[model samples]
Target: MESLLDISKAEKKNKLYDSITPNRFKRTIIKDWQLYVLCAPVIIYFLIFEFGPMYGVQLAFKDFIIGKGIWGSPWVGFKHFERFFTSYQFNIILRNTLVLSIYSLAAGFPFPVILAIMLNNIRGERFKKIVQTTTYAPHFISVVVFCGMINIFLSPSTGIVNFFIKQLRLEPIFFMGKASMFSHIFVWSDIWQNTGWAAIVYIAALSGINPELYEAAKIDGANKLKSIWHVDLPGIMPTIITLLIMRIGKILSLGFQKAYLLQTPLNIDASEIIATYTYKVGLLDAQYSYSTAIGLFNTVVNILLLIMANQLSKKFNDVSLW
Candidate 1:
């Protein structure tokens, strides 16, 4: 009898909790209605522009005839993917993309952090602002304009770079025309263009760090370098790791614009990346299904990399996107 009564009481309590939940939810909605209204446009934008086009990903699996709509098209499964994998250009494209992306990441990743730290240590406000403005101005230049500037500046006969070489009696080199020079030019130019803008995030992170930590480090007889090493680095490590993980996740996603603009017949071996190839095949060559499969593969790889990086970050540093 006691057991029966306990069971009946438990059921009644559960029933009461369930009955209260909807009322509580309704009250919350009433209180937060304005916040929800503010969020509605962003939510709607993502649903329409981002999530809506996901339906077209089906083109990757189908032969995709325009006459036969998406649902009407017959599926070829992994045929296009297999063809891409087996193609002769596969190795070359993948190699060039990986090399450029990895080189860019390795060369460009630390400069922003270094810049931010250096700027943080600056004692003169006026001088610091001048340096910041000088560095940041390049980021505002359009990519096409930047590429044009590169071409003009690197021209063998007429460019300033070659003018210096001529003074030294050395042969003028075509920087953009050489396959080996392509990665260097791309990486260094990008670093010069974007480092200051990228450092803003790190600078913001550094600003949020407690000033008392620096004082404590000085009290402990630590010098400026030691203080930075002990306090500044540890304080901003989470930001660094988060950014690093994001960069790693996009290992294969090199920008097509600058690469395409800088590409010449001589440097095509080093510059034909996945993005440019996809654009050519998909839009220019009219191989819609094939290009879709390549894009899907690229996306799938990026997603896997993101998951892997997140997991590794969580395990090692206890910081992750999740």
Candidate 2:
């Protein structure tokens, strides 16, 4: 009986192996030919444009020389990372990155939500359209042009802001040159540029909210603010959570373009961030490997923050990216 059972088990294992074996690629193509065809271009694009370039990440671990190329370079693992960590500029750059990101996240994140709520509450369609159009126009303005306008508008000698200061018997302040004003100017400019554009997504989410919920809240004698707090906010909480998670994921990243464009020599102490640091190192200094290491570090931190935020959101509110 024992011998028979052993033979039977061997046969069963062979049968299972046979059942699992097949021309998997052909079978998959046959099963979802159209879907595969549709995704082929996107898959190919990412493979070429995204994953292909990922090979260069090895530069971060190498003592890269232009003549030697990335693959031919001498291995110097963690040297650049150590240099960046111990450098005198490390704390300054890290502090600027954290403080600016936090300020932007705290101040810029809610403007869109508030704008969406207000715009949704508008009784007049024409008025709402006008407001949205006026607000969104700024988003399309080129960064250089926008910063130029800001400089012109804030110029101490002749600018409108300084003129107002003069009228109020206050000494003229050069807003651009003030380090203390850098984060506020960056955040408010971001809000002004992006608030209305961001509102479109929140407004779309709000539209999907059931009108019956509002009606029920109204019947229960809830005022406009109370109804919004109870019904509208709850309805949009998922959207809010998702956006908040995305915001947290970008907590260390501020786009280099606007900040770089707006940064003056006087404000460089406060405006220098990881992105700008990378740009200067890679582009200006031509220290490709060191810059890549810094970039890789930034990416890892962003990923970690994203995971942490998602976990916290799930535990606290039962809302998560996954």
Candidate 3:
């Protein structure tokens, strides 16, 4: 009872102290003003390039006449949004977008983790560095160049990939031209390009694990596999959860350039994602308000998914983006 009284008194004291003082956060910021000054450019960049443009999001609801301008534009409420929702292309585009996103997420998410674990297990540092360099190099390739390379490498008539198929007594397949092959090609290529880069954080997390934990495991007679299962995974699971939440937040916002570049008349049925559709309608057809509405809808879904994922993570594992 005395210990409980002492705890209550301590809490009251802390509350009194907090109430009498300015915010600790503000004080810390003021104390670290120089660091904040150095961070000013990044803050300003986001304020300008990221949040600044949000003012025009109202254009999604307004009839954005060139002459009238954004401020002068007349509001149409949900006219554009309703139009997009009720359009013939709505279901098709949404399905294609969701399918591609989910497919890519399922296939691409785990390979990096597996790669990181494998790479961590490697004893030879030189070979590991070489593997990391080779895997990470493709991520630096420009979208246009990467798409071009995909086209050339997967070409039925001239590509080396098809040559291997011919060697197995199979027909030379026109992979880029086939609708069925579109998702496979897109997902696999994305995995290949990003796995190494994505594993970097996991590798860092693994590196940060306390050596004493491994020593303990060894003292317990735990084998290498058991040590990894018991120590390594739990250490990096936070990173995995955080990254998963972020990726969930971007589930709909697939790269427009790669999908657009990969698209062909033959594969349009499968490759017509929301981004490409938005591009065609917004820029090419000059339906700005309608496309903006669609984009806003996509963003709203992402926000909701992010919240849901964060909540679930926190509830189940005490890990979340928040």
Candidate 4:
């Protein structure tokens, strides 16, 4: 009888707790109305510009006709997707996109971390600031301007790079015209442009690490490299993993502007990526449905990659975006 009464009391307490949760939530909303009001614009902006546009994604599956409208357009049931898969350019575009994205990730990801660590270890504040400014200045250069600079520097006739080659009694190579050199130029230039800006986040993470850990490592006779290997890396590991996952998720979404700007007839074989292909087919050729299908396919691949990366990270490191 006593046991039954205790169980009943526990059930009653749970019921009472559930009943009061809504009232508590309502009270919190009333108290925090100003905070919600401040966030309203951002919420409204996303709803209007982001979520609102998703309604048209159905064009990917339909024979989209401007006169007929999205709802009235006849559903084609994967016809565009099939056409894209069987197209001759499919393999080339996919290969170029993956190769460029992977190359960029592999070449560019570590530089920022290495830079942040080096900057954090600097003893002189003045030298650090100067180095930081010099490194970060490239990131502010406009993409178009950067591409123009690349063209100027790599020009066989009047370029500084070819000037050195001529001085060495060698033929001046047309760097921008070589299909083999496109990926290298794109990746290295991107690294140079973005490394310092990317390092800022790691620097912020390093700052938030507890100073006592470093002190303790020193007490244990750990040197600079050892401390960094142990305390510094481990402290900022979650940030690193999060960023890595994000990068992997965007493995196919190479920037269209840079690739398109850098593209030439000679380099087109290696530089014609999915983004440029989509633009040509969508706007240039006026194949709206086809382009939409390609875009949807790209999005689906990204989503899958994101989920896989998140899952793998969670399994190995117990860190995940979800």
- How many clashes does each candidate structure show, in the order listed? 0, 0, 0, 0
List the candidate 2 regions with Cα displacement exceeding 4 Å: 1-21, 30-41
Please give the RMSD to the true structure for each candidate, in Å.
6.0, 7.1, 4.7, 5.2
lDDT of each: 0.92, 0.90, 0.92, 0.94
Best by lDDT: 4
Cα deviation at 154, candidate 4, in Å, is 1.0
Query: TM-score, each model?
Result: 0.89, 0.89, 0.86, 0.88
Question: Taking the tens digit of each residue's C-alpha lDDT, what string does model 3 give over 130-242?
Answer: 99999988899999999999999999999999999999999999999999999999999898788999989889999999999999999999999999899989989999999
lDDT of 2 by residue, 1-322 (tens): 9999999999988766665657654665688899989999999999999998799999989988888887999999899999999998889989999998998888888888899898877799999999988988988999999898888988999899999999999999999898888888888888888899988888999999999988999999999999889987888889999989998998887789888988899998899999999999999999999999999999999999999999999998999888
Name the runs in model 1 displaced over 4 angstroms.
1-44
Residues 29-50, model 1: lDDT tens digits:
8988999999999999999999
* Model 2, residue 83: C-alpha shift (Å): 0.6
TM-score of 1: 0.89
Per-residue error (Å), model 2, residue 237: 0.7
Residue-level lDDT tens digits of model 4 in 211-293:
99999999999999999999999999999999999999999888899999999999999999999999999999999999999
Provide the global lDDT of candidate 3 against the true structure.
0.92
Ranking by lDDT: 4, 1, 3, 2
- Model 2, position 285, has a per-residue lDDT of 96
**Model 2: lowest-lDDT 10 consecutive positions:** 19-28
Which segments of candidate 4 are over 4 A away from where they belong?
1-44
